[model samples]
Target chain A: MDTDLARERILDAAEDLFYARGIQAVGMDAVRDAAGVTLRRMYQLFPSKGDLVEAYLARRDARWLDSLATHVDTVGPTAQARVLAVFDWLEDWFARPDFHGCAFINSFGELAGTSPQVTAAARHHKDAFHAYLHQLTTAAGATAATGAQIALLAEGAMTTAAISGTPAPARHAKAAALNLLTLDARPVASPA
Target chain B: MDTDLARERILDAAEDLFYARGIQAVGMDAVRDAAGVTLRRMYQLFPSKGDLVEAYLARRDARWLDSLATHVDTVGPTAQARVLAVFDWLEDWFARPDFHGCAFINSFGELAGTSPQVTAAARHHKDAFHAYLHQLTTAAGATAATGAQIALLAEGAMTTAAISGTPAPARHAKAAALNLLTLDARPVASPA
Candidate 1:
């Protein structure tokens, strides 16, 4: 197998297995078998399980963010609409049969206590996500704080939707975000 | 050892171990060792690992909800204050040294895919929590939809605070909850 192709195949299997069945539950041998790569080739591509896990998360982080941003760019027309569009994107995601939850949140919950690499990866993913929301809210003439609050609604919707097995939280969160935007954009009155 | 005490000890240890390390990473042997019970006693009490996990989550659900209610009742003098008190309770929880996020969220992330018991337990916990918030919001003269939106803020705060290792999300969530309450309670003007 070509080295790059073998690497991608390995990561693809690893991501699917890890996301579906928690990280500790899936072994490197399972990943090799699923990827159709020999143990020797798998080891060569990722020397250790830790290295493989890190690569899986790093790739996922990039891919997930890119997908969200692309959707936002495609559908969101104005600053406020862009913010609400995130929840629309989330509703679609939550409705998918394969949707579990936020990979970063799930990964952190499953491994952050024992794995610092996992902790850093989860933190970095969220920081980047929060920053993206802040930029959107800033463009909408809202405070950074409002941006953080909006981000909370999005985060909440993901977990809630995943656990409840419904996409309704996304709608609730979008409504809340709209209300926050309206309230935050209100002009402060000068003393009479 | 008394059966009831042994069960409690086992659950206490299991909860700590499972929360500190992911559930799959901590075996029944580790739980027995941590609880200082014999293998025979442990098996006699829990029957299986699944049973132990269920018991841990069940006890946690009751206790966690009770803790939130107790705090809310003590600090919240009015309906609006009661609703915001939920966030304050979350802030204190996030600040705890051993805080690892919502147990149900973590457990669902770790085991819900494979364990029906875990899936049900997670769903039940979240349902009960959302219902409690709905009750509070209704008392505060907000619509059920507004109640759900506020619940999303609390849910988001838990996940964010866990990943970021900061209690600040609780404050952000509290502020957002306040805004939601205000917006939700506004009386619609009759046609003039």
Candidate 2:
């Protein structure tokens, strides 16, 4: 196989294993085994476990955001619905059998303080997410601060859903986001 | 030392090590060295790493909530202000030299998928936190859902602050919580 294909398989395996088992608990040999790559080929591609981990996170970030954006774009009629569509996407992701929270959040929890690469990756992913929210919320007629608040609600939803073993937090956060976004214009009822 | 005291020291050491370093990265030997306890005593106290981890979370939960309650109680004039005090507590916490996000969050990120004990501890901690927010928000005249929203904001703040290496998210979340709590009553001026 080409180096590109080899690299993709390794990252796919690493993302699965790392997300399931935490980074520290998984070793490169396990990645090689899971990816069906030889030890030499895996090392040739990644050089180190850290390198593989970074690639895994970077790939996952792009893919995850793409999925969210695709869903948002599919359902888009207005900016506000697109902004709210993220939680709907989150609910779908949470319901997946293999879903395991935001990979960036999970990776940050496992490696942020010790690994600058991991920290930078997580920071980059989160910043992009916040920027997306800012753009969407601003287009939806909310201030940048409203965008920031909505980002917090979404981030909080990710954490709560991951830990609480339920996707309900996504709906909870979506309702709150609606209040925060629309309260400037109309009367609001409590989220039922 | 008495068994209970030995256990306390063990938990203290474990908490420091686990929080600074990811849980899976720290070993029992390092914990023993940090606590200055005998291997036999460590085993007698914890039996396994999972037991020590559970104890660490259980202890931290009580202490963290207690600290939040103390700050809220000391600075009380209104239920709304008391509810907002959580952000003040978060700001202070974020400023702490050793602060590395909530212990339960970090642990859940590290072990929740595989460890039932850690999962239960993290879920319980998050639920209790949500309950506290519910009690306070209801007292402050918001719906239970409003309290849930504030909890999401606070959880999001913990995440953003921890990853972004700043305390500003706490204030951002506080502003959002204020808006959430008071949206029905007045204009929010966009969280400035």
* Candidate with maximal lDDT: 1
lDDT of 1 by residue, A60-139 (tens): 99998999899999964699988888899999999999899988888888888889999999999999999999999999
After aligning candidate 1 to the native by TM-score, how far in Å is the CA of B76 from where it should be?
Answer: 4.7
**Every model's TM-score on chain B:** 0.95, 0.94
Q: Where does model 1 sit among the CAPRI classes?
A: medium
Q: Where does candidate 2 stray beyond 4 Å?
A: A185-192, B184-192
Q: Given candidate 2, what's the lDDT at residue B8? A: 83
- Using all chains and alpha carbons, the TM-scores for the candidates as numbered come to 0.96, 0.93
How many clashes does each candidate structure show, in the order listed? 0, 0
How would you encode candidate 2's per-residue C-alpha lDDT over B1-192 as one tens digit per residue? Answer: 888888888888998999998888898999999998999999987888888888888998999899898899997669899999989999999988877888888888888778889889998999998898889888888887888899999999999998888988899899889888887455344532
Q: Candidate 2 at residue B87, lDDT? A: 92
> At residue B39, what lDDT does model 1 achieve?
89
Interface RMSD of each: 2.3, 3.3
